[model samples]
Target: MLSQKAKYALRALMMLAEAAPEELVLVQEIAERQNVPKKFLELILLELKRHGFVFSQRGRGGGYCLARPADTITFGQVIRAMDGPLAPLPCASVTGYRRCADCADERTCTIRKVMRRVRDAMADILDKTTLADVRGGRVDEDLLATVA
Candidate 1:
């Protein structure tokens, strides 16, 4: 499940993605436009800046902007930055893999196998879908149709 923080972060990023390349959007403006709480958005923006997703300017005319092109920023990257791995379980994570403490044999674990497939399917879509794709409504319709 996507956390509220992650949802807010994505909304904020989408707002940034819509801005002019050199435009610096104030936190207050972003909060108002995206309907995110200003205090929480400050923390979220700081995290995103640390992850190199955004850059901040201090003082007068200060604000935030995408650190890279929106098309270069994948939803998977943002989600992982805010929510860790896309995997349903630690043992199923390719990026943060850890054996389940109670599992005697991971290779033979039915749950892990199913979750690995789930993780792969999620990564396949999220990693390929960029902020620009989403903001522009360019997501693969056939894929969405299949899912629906």
Candidate 2:
């Protein structure tokens, strides 16, 4: 399940992706445009900045902008930044894998096997889909085929 914070972060990033190159967007403007709470957005933006997704400028004409090109930024990266591992369970996580406490044998665990497949499928799509693809509505045929 996607958290409210993650949703807001994606919305904010999409807005940044749509901006002119090197354009610095004010937090207030993003909050208003995206219908996100200003205070909450400030915290979210700060976290994103810490994660290297965005860069913030201080003082007059100060604002935030993408730290890298939108096409270079994957949805998986942003989601992981905002929500940690993409796997449904710790044991299924590729980046933050851990054995399930109840599982006696991971290799033979049916639940873990299914979950690992789920995680891989999700990662396949999310990692390949970038902010540019989403913003431009350019759905990859291969992705659609994979999903189907």
Q: Which candidate is the best by lDDT?
A: 1
lDDT of candidate 1 at residue 56, scale 0 to 100: 98
For all candidates in order, the CA lDDT equals 0.92, 0.91
Clashes of 1: 0
Residue 102 lDDT (model 2): 92
- Which lDDT tens digits does candidate 1 get at residues 87-144? 9999999999999999999899999999999999999888888888877445668658
lDDT per residue as tens, model 2, 4-25? 9988999999999988877999
Q: List per-candidate RMSD values in Å.
A: 1.3, 1.4
Which 10-residue window in model 1 sums to the lowest lDDT? 134-143
Best candidate, TM-score-wise?
A: 1
Off by over 4 Å in 2: 136-142
